[model samples]
Target: MQNLEEAELCFPQLLNISCKKHIRPQAEAMFIYIVLSSISLLTVALNLLVIISISHFRQLHTPTNLFILSLAVSDFLVGLLVMPFQILLTEPCWLLGDLVCALYYLLNFITLCASVFNMVLISVDRYVAICDPLHYPTKITAKRVQVCVFLCWGYSVFYSVMFLYDNLKQPGKYNSCYGECVINIIGPADLVLGFIIPISAITILYVRVFVVAVSQARAMRSHIISVTMKHSSTVTAKKSELKAARTLGIVVAVFLMCYCPYYCVSLSLVIGSSTEALMIFVAFFNSCLNPVIYALFYPWFRKSVKLIVTLEILQPHSCEANIL
Candidate 1:
């Protein structure tokens, strides 16, 4: 009986002060480790490819790609810094000390916030580009994008600090026992600030962009001559519709799909539970999905990946290669 009890304790030496080991099956734990580790590695690798693709290929540089690069940087950090720590959480106990746990949560807050904000920025960028194409060049310049990216990150840090203020002040205050790492997040505020605002902004902006795009498509078709031009005009009109649909599908649909459940779970105010972990992981999976979508939507990304994998970028003045 004593042996069994000791086995259940996270820190056997602590006796009464120790947290109990998580009561998951060995096989299940291994399965989770394998899956999450694979995701972490894939996230890191894919986001790294995006970072290299944008930074190395000179012609690929643009205001839009700059937002993507900022996103890749945040996603890259999520895979590198946050995911591994999260995986560690699936273990028997939190071996890392209290301050590390607090820091980990802080980093997680920053990255997730940065990702959502970056998406908003991307949505606004597209809105301007599509709805006001005439002013796009003058309005959404590279320098302006750089400033937005900087502010996005800065706000992420500020938001994180405000969100986790109490816990940051007293790391591990909510831990039930010595070997546990738990945090108490400020409520309603997380749901409102993190979920409602950003999601609403993205949805509204994308809806406007879609409306404009469809109208433009109709206008183009109306002006199209009805001769040999008919077939080509129809093709162009269809492409416009397809592009608008795709933007909605990828940006809004995927974002809602990934984030909704997590926020729904958060609404219940259940933090630091197995169910919460599952829901949060679903949200983090968005980082992994981002690069996949990029590869699908951006031809330059595919071309740049080819050049990068071939190591052709090592050649002299390879940045000048016109992948666009």
Candidate 2:
């Protein structure tokens, strides 16, 4: 019963209210959101600390550390650049103009793609190191690491541009709620490109890496047993190899834990009409969980924490010596 001009004026406000009502829960949903947000913030802070410590400390600049540094940087950026906007813009209407919304979406896609690809590269690097230790030096040199990092950024930018181009061409297809950026449910293309392909590739790489690592561990144990025929020495080397294998396994496990649910939620959005807002929140939570996983499993991070604690305990004595 309204004219076109009146309808246009009223539409955005209506959409905004709808978005807020949907996100503002009675009780349970708010609790979940708060808990997840807390976890995410904590994870981001931890990753930031880890990255800063590794970068500032000269002793922690090995190849393995370099890969970890890359991972931490990606996680930190996701936490900083993507999650906060997503959490704040949960209302049905976007307060930031269209330009800002578009830019945020673009950056979100780019950083996520970069993170996933970096995981794949890390897995491949681990595979090479475990499967062929001698050739690993030639295959995964510092130069190669730099090249891989460069390619990750380049590929992320290229694909992100393509995605943005496609998205901008059909802006009307998306539901522009304040809190949600629900793209039109395109065919399998979105699902495949956004979630399935990257997850599958990473999963495959990790599976192969696991198989190779287990075989290597067994072979190394057998070799040690045969060489000195001393159980104690064999046990020590076995423990070292086991520790290394466990570290790699934890990395893969963390990747699966933090990302698999996100991919599932994304696929569900593409394939069905479910709660897009909830799914987006879940995916955001994954970005925050990565740092917790690192803290639990990463040996270098654990060592760094201990070193920090020790230095703090020794600080007073060092200060007194300097004064004297």
Candidate 3:
């Protein structure tokens, strides 16, 4: 009985060759399951709302929103495909075998990379709109945004495949025992490509955005008493830009907070420990966090959700309805 408890083979029939179960307390496992499951469901539901809202509403069909739509689609996939597999990974046994595990991590990487790319696109959109408003409309057309989205997804697939090439070539290559699943990351490469480059782009762009926004806000304040301020085209444009920068800045800030820890850890060393699982999941949890931020800050998202939930969108000409 003591040996059985101590060994706790993931596959008892295999005995010596089976992996030992790394079982937590039953209560702790149960809580983790419930939390992760809830996150999965919420992530799916909220991202679907964003997708439907943007796709079905004509008013929401702008360049900035195109980036958001792309992000929603990626988050939707994370919920639909990645999160469930992640939940299974938490289990003591690898019931589905090595190929599925490889697929799970692949899907995970693709969605996350796509999301980061979308964010970069969004920041660029905002940057152009605020910093270079005259050329913004011409520069950020729907076709261009669509092409960028496609490229982002394509790059994500290529990157993920290359990153996990060995594991894809030989499933179970890293497993020391049957019923165990493990994959190691090349920390230095991950830190450079995944963490440093993308994060640097996002940070630099947002910093420029912040500087412009703050300067514009001060200009508005200084001219507040002038009646002409309201009618000034420059003033009006600056106000709009400031508001947009503020909203999207909140989103980018939250993204940094959620993504930082995992990549920060990746910078120092390898990530095959038990604690790495928690860090990865924490980063994955950002998939759900974004839509909640949208719901809180975006009146259009709130209105669209109401319209969708109440089935008002089924009415003919509903897409023509004003969402903004």
Top-TM-score candidate index:
3
Clashes of each: 0, 5, 0
Q: What are the candidates' C-alpha RMSDs? A: 3.0, 6.0, 2.0
Q: How many steric clashes does model 2 contain?
A: 5
Q: How far is 176's C-alpha from truth in model 1 (Å)?
A: 1.8
Q: How close is candidate 3 to the true structure, as a TM-score?
A: 0.94
After superposition, candidate 1 runs with Cα above 4 Å error: 226-249
Over the stretch 35-77, how does candidate 3's per-residue lDDT look in tens digits? Answer: 9999999999999999999999999998888899999899899
Model 2: ten consecutive residues of lowest lDDT = 315-324
Q: By TM-score, highest first, what's the ranking? A: 3, 1, 2
Q: Give the alpha-carbon lDDT of every model.
A: 0.86, 0.64, 0.86
TM-score of 2: 0.75
Could you tell me the lDDT of residue 107 within candidate 2? 83
Model 1 sits at a Cα RMSD from the real structure of 3.0
Candidate 2: tens digits of C-alpha lDDT, residues 1-324? 444433433244554332433334558657756876776687688777678657755666556567777877777877777877776565434556555666777788788778777777777776666666657768887777877888888888887767777565655246544433544334367568766777787678768767876776677667764665556664564454446556756765666675666567656654323455556665556556656665676665666666555674245443222110
The deviation in Å at residue 269 for candidate 1 is 2.5
> How big is the RMSD of model 2?
6.0
Q: How accurate locally is residue 249 in candidate 3, as Cα lDDT from 0 to 100?
A: 83
